[model samples]
Every structure is written in C-alpha cells, then in structure tokens.
Target: MMAALRRRDFLFGSSLLLASPFFMRAARAASPRIISLDYGLAQTLIEFGTPPVGLIDTPGWYDWVMEPPLPPGIANVGSNYEINMEMLQLLQPDLIISTPYLEWIRPQLETIAPVKSFPIHAVGSSPYPHIIAATLELGQIVGQPQQAQALIDRTERDLLAAKAATRRLAEQKLAIMTFMDARNIRVYGPGGIFQDVLDRLELQNAWTRRTNEWGFSDAGLADLIGIGDSRIFYMDPVPADVLAGLAGSPLWQAMPFVQKGHAQRMASVLMFGALPSVSRFARLLAEVKV
Candidate 1:
C-alpha cells in the first residue's frame, strides 16, 4: 500500500510540473511587438516608452516634431506612402498600425500581421479628442491601455494650462502660413491643424477660406494683406539669407502687417498630423507675447 501511494504521489507531482508553463502562459500577459506606420502613432509609442521596432518615413528635415532623432536600432520600413513589404515581413512584428489614408496598403500588410488604421485627420473631427482616441486605441492594442489613458490625461492638462496662460490675448487674430516652396506660400485656413490650436485659444484665424486636402491654400504675398491689422504667423523656417531676400522684396516689405510690426516668424513646428507636433505648437503659443 505504501509503495503504491508513493508512486501515485510522484506521478501527480510530475504532471503538475509539466503543466506549470502552460498555466503560467495562460495567466501571463504577452508583450506585443508592434510596427508603427504613422509618425503620430510612433510619437505616442515613444511617449509610452515602447518605441516602435520599425517605422515608415523618418526624415531629418523635420526637427521640430521628432527632435533628438529616433531611438537607435529602429529600422525604417520605407517612406510614408510607400512601405517596403520585404523589410516589414523580415521584422516579424506581431501588429501593424497605420493611418486611414494608407488603407490601400492594408491588404498587403495584413498578410504579415493584424493591421489597424485610424484617420489621422478625420473630416469635421476635433483634433484633440481624435488624437486622444487614437492613442487610447493604440495602447489597448499593445496591451498598455492604462499607460495610454495616463498619457492622454497628461497631454490634456498641459494643453489646458497653455490655453489658460494665453486666454488674456484670446482676441488676438493670428495667421499661420508655410512656404509650399520658394515661389509659393500656403496659409492654414479653416479645418487646418493650426486652426484647431487657434480655436482652442479663441484666437481668430486671419485666413478664413477653405484649405485644400493638405489643409492649406496657395497664395501670393499680397493675399496676406487681407488680415488688415491682424498678426501674421509664418510657420516655416526662413534662413538668414531668405530673410534678407524677403526684406529686399518690395511686395513683402510693403505688406500692411509687416509695416505695422504685426508680422512674426514662428519656428517651424511640424504641422503634420501628430501629438508631439501639437505639443510643440502649444509651447510656442505659450511663449509668444501676443
């Protein structure tokens, strides 16, 4: 009887030991390896301390948005519009995230792993809420839902604080424009990213016309004169030489806003769709006197 009991006990112990890993695996959460195809999502992930293992287009030209550079060891999958399938497959990511604008590429990426695409610039959407929703969704997908909520809360608090700081000058009319290239300039009008920021501060946008798909309208220097006495905020980098050239231009010098000292050059904050970019804009607003 004692010998039989001993044998049964040993067998039971062996079985439990063999099943331990499976049980633990069932209870233990898995950390998903994600590939981020959107710059905004990538910025959110970095804030969450889980920088993507791979990214799409990361260029050095935009320093105001992704200052300090991407974390080392993160591979570039391809440009924003064109993702390299071969490299993406080799990375073996468990999930892929992208913007809704990139929906055409979803079918190809789905072959590798599950893909989630949200509209980065949804029509008639409030930028703040939309971005918070995106971040929360991303966190849930990556098994970090709590972290996402915390980040959203923090960002809102910061934004609110910034807005309050500028409330005294809320009536100031502000215009944000960027150079499309050397020859033409584009101004952020209704429904633009900067427009959202301006609305939050209750600042009037000098440009009231509808923008193109990219949220800007091409215009000559003369078009800016319509703002009358409003402040003009230029949102592109103007090198010293370019500034000198503009100073030399008769049309630029004769602009009513420039003559009245209402023309100001704002640092080129990344106007592209992203939270980090918006944060930069908020900071800039906080620093400006009017």
Candidate 2:
C-alpha cells in the first residue's frame, strides 16, 4: 500500500511539472508591449505594474504631481505631438495608448500599431471617472485587469479621504488660473480639471464666464480683474520678473482679492487643466497651504 501511494504522488508531481511550461507560456503571452502617448496613460501603466516600453514626455514622470520617476530602462519617444516615428517603428509595440484629443495624429500612429484613445477631457467626462475607465480599458488591452482594479480602488479611497479632510473648508470660493508669459493669462472656467477639483471640495469657481471649447479662456490683466472677487489660486510657477510686473501693474494691484492677499501661487501640475488621476489631484490639494 505504501509503495502504491508513493507512485501516485510521484505521478501527480510529474504531471504538474509537465503542465508548468504551458501555463508559463500562456502567462507570458498575456502581457503586451505598449507605447503610451499621454502622460496620464503612462502613469496608469506604472500603476498597473506594466510600464510602457516607450513614453512621450519622460520628464513629466518626475515633475508630475505624483512625482514617481520613470524606470531607467524605459525609452523616451519625444513630445506627445511629435512622437519619434523611427523609434516607434523599431520598437514595434503591440499597443499604442493616447487621448482622444490627439485623434489628428491617429492616422500616422495607426500605421505602426493598434491605437486606443480615451476621451479624458470630453464634454461631461469627469477626471476621476475618465482615469478609472482609461486604466481599466488599458488593463484589458494589456492583460492587467486585477492591477487596474486595485489602482482604481486605491484612487477612490484616497480622493474620499482628501475630501473628508477638507470638508470644513468647502465653502471657500476658489479661482485657478495661469499666467501666460507676461502679457496673457489663461483661466479655467466651468467643466475643467480645476473646476472639478473645486467642485469636489464643494468650493465655487469665481469665473462663471464661458471658456473656449477646451475649457480655458485667455484674458489680459484688465480682463482678469473682471472675472470675480474669489480668492485666486494662480497655477504654474511664475518667474520673479513676472511677479514684479504683476505687482507693479495698477490693474493687478487694485484687484480686491490681490490687495487683500487672497491670491496664492500653485505649482503647475495639470498643464492645460487636465488632472491625470486622483493621486495627482490629491497631491495638488495636499500641497495647497490655504
């Protein structure tokens, strides 16, 4: 009886060993080589534990609100608008992820590989939902469903916590804008990432004026004063000279909010006012002194 039992155990172990290679091959076949064109998509890939082989805007990895540097082995594919076609052809990625706004570049990129676009900034598309959907969609394309779900769950929890922390200050009226060099300024109006952040905090957007189709409006110093009396949160790092210029401008200095010291400077996180993820947005809010 003992001999028979030993033989059966040996056969079971051998069977698993024989099947192991097939399972390993199936697992290896699951993960696809992906090229990400958007910074948000690149961040999603990292969250999913399957970073892209090549990415546009590698510097964004460090400068981004999340501040996680890209791994050394990853290749830079140039700017989002100007991808290196030669390098992309050489890499031959299985999938290319981009934002819907870059649809104009689709024809050129599709020649290389399958391309997927997420309409992150589309009308009525909220940042949190868009990021979650994009991450899950990319996971399906790259065979990382479990990782994608985990990231979404984590993001949701973090956002909820941040909201709870700031619940008491929900009544604050906030305005987010950026100085464009010395002469022009861009302000986020309704239906923008900054607006979304303000909405989450239950704060009001001072600027009720309609922005361009992309949710940003250009204004001169004189026009900015007309926006509202809400405490202004200037996005992006302004140079000392620009700050001095604003300080000297009668139009800027005379603004009630500015004169009352209700204006503050913020680091440029969401360039163009698109929050990539909850993690990024939460970090932006966490760093806000006021």
Q: Who wins the lDDT comparison? A: 1
Candidate 2 local Cα displacement, residue 30, angstroms: 5.0
Q: Estimate the TM-score for candidate 2.
A: 0.80
Assess candidate 1 and give its lDDT: 0.69
TM-score of each: 0.81, 0.80
- Highest TM-score: give the candidate number: 1
Error of 2 at 122 (Å): 3.7
Q: Residues 26-144, candidate 2, lDDT per residue (tens digit)? A: 23444557788877777777767788899887766654434345667888888866889998888777667788788998999888876777777645544555655667776665556
lDDT of each: 0.69, 0.67
- Model 2 residue 125 lDDT? 41
lDDT of 2 at 123: 56
Model 1, residue 7: C-alpha shift (Å): 36
Residue 69 in candidate 2, Cα distance off native in Å:
3.0
**What TM-score does structure 1 among the candidates reach?**
0.81
Query: Least accurate stretch of 10 residues (summed lDDT) in model 1?
Result: 20-29
